[model samples]
Target chain A: MANLSIRSVSKSYGAVSVLDDVSVEVEEGSFVVLLGPSGCGKSTLLHAIAGLNPIDSGTIVIGDRNVTNLPARERDVAMVFQSYALYPTMSVAENIAFPLKMRGLDRKTSDEKVVAVAKLLQIEPLLGRKPRELSGGQRQRVAIGRALVRDPRLFLFDEPLSNLDAALRTELRAEIKRLHQSIRRTMVYVTHDQTEALTLADKIVVLKAGRIEQIGTPLSLYDDPDNAFVAGFIGTPRMNFLRATVADGGKTLHAGEASVDISHLATRLEAGRNVMLGIRPEHLDEKQGVTLSLAVDVTERLGSTSYVHGMLPSGETVVAERREDQPRFGETITLRFLPARTRIFDAQGMRIR
Target chain B: MATAASDPTRHFFQPIIVCLTVASVALTLFVIWISLHDLSLMRAGREKFVGLDNYLRFFGDPRAMAALWRTVLFTTLATVVEIALGLAVVLFLDRDFAMKRLVRTLLLVPIIMTPVVVGLTWRFLFDPATGMANYLLSLAGLSQVDWLGSPQLALYSVLIADIWQWTPFVILLVMAALESAPTDPLNAARVDGAREWQVAWYVLLPMLRRALAIVALIRAIDSIKAFDLFYIMTRGGPALSTETLNYYGYIAAFTNFDISYALAIAIILTIFTNVALLTMYSVLFPKSGER
Candidate 1:
């Protein structure tokens, strides 16, 4: 296991920069996930660390060595590609045993290691099957086995579960978490799936436009994002943002027919300043202290929880989490905001501390 | 032509087989009728039934046996050498280079040139005293070599010309296969600690095995029936060193005027070539259950 330190790493293709001076510190035996939307350079940063894609600048320090210029094999990093990338010609055992064989390990020992990895990944019965003969989930397990058999210093995963079906993705995601638990190696994973990042990461690095937006624990990032983009990107049924103008001499925010009192807002703002008030769906309650009201337009029930989508008089929609029942479309509903949980971003998108 | 209305997509084999069977039966009847007779160009229409005499006489002829052996040797050598050399060139030029497009275009010149042109060009180049081959030998302080005159070197001179003309054909085929093969497995091999050569041998080459087999099959078939280069360069000269089966069949019909025996030789050569190629194809692409 090794701690990975990426310092001022930047990569560009022609004039377009893909990773602009991105840096992250991952502790040994921790799982760090780079989470972002498409074209956000999370995959590029992972490739840079793996040495598959060379960085244009900066150094990558792993353990005690600076391996910035080392080739992928020389760096002792094994990758699980999104496509699985198994050798189609080789059987599962040979695919898993390849790295050990390349390192010149004895056949007997290598075979034993292959069996151990196969058992770990629960792919022991598939040892004789070619990759083409295996299903997507089975291929994923074999790819993991290949990476695990190497016992590399750091493991890099490039959206390894994106291609699988939902059930299989969840299954593999949990298995990967367990693998990290058992092996306790430093692993850096890249994915655009926020749920996977929230579930699998010890530290989540949120990225946007080739730059790091925030780096923190998953809950910290979800609860306290650094900017409007980070706030918008981290959660599903995403954080609701309402354009509000300061009113009542810097004491309240007014938007359409919904007005939220800003008297207890953590940050002081001058009167007439414009800001976006962000709140999570579950935080919008009918029985909380600070409150706003909007007319209910639509609602959806997902068994235990319900999502209530309401519309302001100005024709803007806002979602709230309700229980059991929903109001009619024409009915007005009062939603109280948890003052401690609400976030405000300026018109320029900077977080209002 | 007056058959009932039929769905075009659903029943294509009926019409196809009807046409194919008519053509096939007529051709087979003609070949078999001629093979059973003592036909010759000089004899005209005074032909008589000879049964299996022509086939038996062919197996007994020493020249015919030697030509058959020469054909097999030439086909095997040409196919193997051309594929190996072509693959080597493809690998050498696989990477980015300043003049890659121009070089690829230039490589096509050899393949697109007519076989007769290639044959005459190599013949001049192999001229004993004044040709470029001997000129290079002189430059290296060696004696002028008889490239096509000596019996031992005559077959090889024709073989070299065949390779020079056809290796680019293999290169073009294998290059297209290489271009479309997925590079993810190869990149994964590099990340899995495989060296450059190991990645090529284990991942990249295995991926091209099917394409290489197809190119080898084509080159093998082409080599077996090759006559233009031999006619242009050697013409089975230098004590019959390059007298291949196809050329021997030519000699039987035109020079010896034994039309029946030449037909027999043609039939036997076709069977041999088909059997050999079928075996090769089966080996390269075995039945899925057989593995």
Candidate 2:
């Protein structure tokens, strides 16, 4: 196990800066996931950590040693590429043993190590087959086995499950989690998939563009997002937002067709200001506190639970969760949100309590 | 049905088309008949039908056997050298460098030049008394060796010219293959901790096997029938050292006036070339289960 410290890492391609002054500390044996959308530089950060890409400015310390200038082979880390870059010519056994061979291990010791890794990865029967001869899932295991046989200080995975189908992704996600538990090695995984980050990571580092948006556990980010971007990006079927002006009605919000009773946020409310109001679908009740009459537009029924897409008379579209026996499309329905579940974003898209 | 007949768009027999097919088949049969007319002259023109007489005489004659051996030796040696040098140049030019296109164009000068012109140019350079090659060797205080005059060295001199002319062809084709080589496998090999030599030896060479095999097979067939260089340089001579099978067949038909023997050699050579091509194909494209 090893701890990793990245200090003010920066990268640029000629003139375009990709990562800027980013720093993070990964504790020993921690599973840290870097989550973001496309071109957010998450994969670049992972590659920088794996020493596959050189950072223009930074010191990367691993296990009390500075490895900033070390080549990838000497950095004592193993990376699983999204493409599962298994050597096409080598059999599964030879591919696994390649790193060990580079380290000057004798044939006997390396073969034993390969066999052990194959057994652990459940790829023993595939030892004699080439990469082209195997299916996608089997090829992934061979790649994992190659990484495992190295026994490096850190494991870096760059969207290793992205190439797999949905069901296979789920299966392999569990397998990776189990492997982490058994090995307990420090890992830095990069993915744009929020679900994978939420399920597998001890800490998730959400990024936007070239900056870190927030870093926390899954529930922490879900319950208390720092900004509108994090709030919108972290959930499925997404949180719904309503555009309206905030005005003082004694101790409650007075805006839109209906005044959302926000007496709970009276201390934080400012009079006569435009703000964005957000509420998650799961937190909305079909009929009940701060009420808005909705003209139902579309209802998506997923057996036992459903999503209702509707609009206020003011033409503000919103999605609300409902049971199967909910209102049909083109009908009038009333939905409400608990005052506690509502989130307020000021004019600049900054979160406000 | 009566209206269909009145349409005049249907014919029971298309007379003009029938004439065309008969004309085409007649033309083909006429060509074959004229080509085989002299074949009977070699077959003894009797019921005897001495099956393998000319073929046996071709193999039995010492001068012809010598030509056969020389052709085999020259073709094998020249093809090997051409492929080896060609692959090296291709690998070198495949990298990013200044003047790459210019250099490649310059290298292609020999390949695109007429073979007879290349041979003529070298023949003048190998002239023992006045050629620049002998002058340069003499400047180095080395004794002047006969390049085209000696039976022993004439074939070697011709081979040098052929290699200079055709090795660029190998370079061009192999360069195309090298440029399109997949980047993923090379990157994977680097991550898997292979050194530069290992990457080239273990990864790249295997990928190039098919391309190199194709180059070798094509060059082999081309070199076996090689004539223009030998005709322009040594004229199959000093004492027939560079006389290949083609040259031998030409000499038999024209110089010795043994037209029947020459035709027999031509048939044998055709069969030999076909067998070589088949063998190369099998070697390159093996069964699925066999590696």
Candidate 3:
């Protein structure tokens, strides 16, 4: 296992830049996730790190060796593609042993390593089956086994679970986490799924439009976002943004038809200034800091807790979490949230302290 | 739930199926009937039932046996050489290059040409005295060689003409297969620490196996029945070196006017071709249970 450092990496295709001056540092044995929506250059960054893509300007150092100009095979990195990219004509055992065979390992040792990886992946019975005979989930397991058999310096995954069904994705995601815990190898994974990033990553790097938006621990990013985009992208049910203006000499915030006292943050708010109030759904409680009324739109129940999506009197859509009583559609409900739990962004979407 | 007569789709297809069955089955029966008799243009009015005599004579005729051997040799060599050369060319052209579409278009010229034209063109090129082959040989300080006149080189000269015309056909098919094949495995092999050649050998070639086998089968079938190039270029050659079974059947029917023997020869060739191709097809596409 080795640490990887990407310095001033930039890649462009003719006139379009895919990765623009991106840099990331992943500590040895840490699981770092590159998380973002599609077209965010998250996969491009992972490919760059794997030496599959040549960056226009960057020096990538892994274990004190600069691999910026090296080919993928020379970089000692194994990548699990989103498509599972198994050698179609090869059986599971041969697919797993391909890297070792290419490295000129002895036949007996390669066979043993293949068996060990198959056992680790719980695919021992499937070792003789060709890829076409395997199901989608089984194929991915073999793909992971292929990457694991080599024990490369770094493991890279490009949305490895995106192709499976929801249940299989969760199962394999947990298996991948368990595998990482057992091996403790340096791994860099790329995915657009925030939940996967939050569950499996030691550090989640949230990217947007070919640039790094925020890089921090999963909880840190969820609890303290650097910008409105990061705040909205990191959370489930999405963070609600309400346009408001400072009033009462910065002691209160006045949205369209409702006003809430912001005495706790009066120092940070200037009178007559416009800002966006960011609130998490879970942060909106039935009994806390300030009261707000919502004209109910819908309620989505998940057995224990329900998400109450409604329009605030301020004319902005908000989702509030409720535990006890469920509210029906078109019912006005009162919810409260701590002013300290809210995040304020300027009109430009930049966080204001 | 629909009976055959009541089904509209089946009604539309029935005439086509009937026509094809009658065309193939009736023709084959007529050929078999004629093969059983001693029918010849030399004695048109005295035709009589020969009852396997023509078939028995084929086994003893040294010329017929030699022609059958020649046919086998030509078909096997043409198929193997064309597939190998075509695959090599396709691999070279797989990458990006200037005028790639133009080059591909140029490769189609030979495939689209009539075999007769290809035969005549190669015949002119192989002329012993004034041909381009000898002129190039003289430029390289080599002696003039008889490409088609010599009995030893005649069959191979025809084989060359067949190869030149059909290798492009193989290229077109294999290239299409290569383009449609998933590139992910190739990339995976590269990342798996395989060298460029290793990736092509282990990953790319295996992926192209089904396509190559199919092309080989088609080329073999075509080579076995190859007639135009032999007719136009060699015409059974100076000493019968290029006398393939098909050409021998033509000679028996037209030159010798032995229609019954010629029909027998054709029937034998058909049976041989079917058996050989069936064996090839089975080898190329083995059953899953066998695997």
lDDT by residue (tens digit), candidate 1, A1-353: 44899999998998999998888889999999999999999988988887788999999998888989988778888999999999888899999999998899999999999999898888999999889899999998999999999789899999999999999999999999999998899999999999999999999999888999999999998888889998988887888988888888887777656567777767778888989988888888746566667788788888888888887667768889887467777888777776567788999887886
As for TM-score, the candidate ahead, 2 or 3, is 3
Of candidate 3 chain A, the 10-residue stretch with the lowest lDDT total is A258-267
Estimate every model's Cα lDDT from 0 to 1. Answer: 0.89, 0.83, 0.91
Q: How would you class the docking of model 2?
A: acceptable
Model 3 alpha-carbon drift over 4 Å, by segment: A247-252, A258-270, B1-19, B127-146, B289-291
Tell me the tens digit of each residue's lDDT in model 2 across B18-94: 88899988875553343333444334443233456777887788988888888789888998999999987776676
Ten contiguous residues with the weakest lDDT in model 2 chain A: A246-255
Scoring only the second chain, what is candidate 2's TM-score? 0.82
DockQ of each: 0.60, 0.30, 0.59
Q: Per-residue lDDT for A47-89 in model 2, tens only? A: 7887778899989998898989987666788888888887776
- Please identify which of the two predictions, 1 or 3, would achieve the higher lDDT against the true structure: 3
Q: First chain TM-score in every candidate?
A: 0.96, 0.94, 0.97
For model 2, the DockQ equals 0.30
Q: On residues B50-131, what C-alpha lDDT tens digit does candidate 3 reach at each position?
A: 8999999999999999999999999999999999999999999998898999999999999999988899899889999889
lDDT of 1 by residue, B42-147 (tens): 9999999989998899899999999999999999999999999999999988888899889878889998899889998999999997799999999999987899
Interface RMSD of each: 1.9, 2.4, 1.9
TM accuracy, model 1: 0.92
Residue pairs with colliding backbones in model 3 are none
Indicate which candidate wins on lDDT.
Answer: 3
Candidate 3, backbone clash total: 0
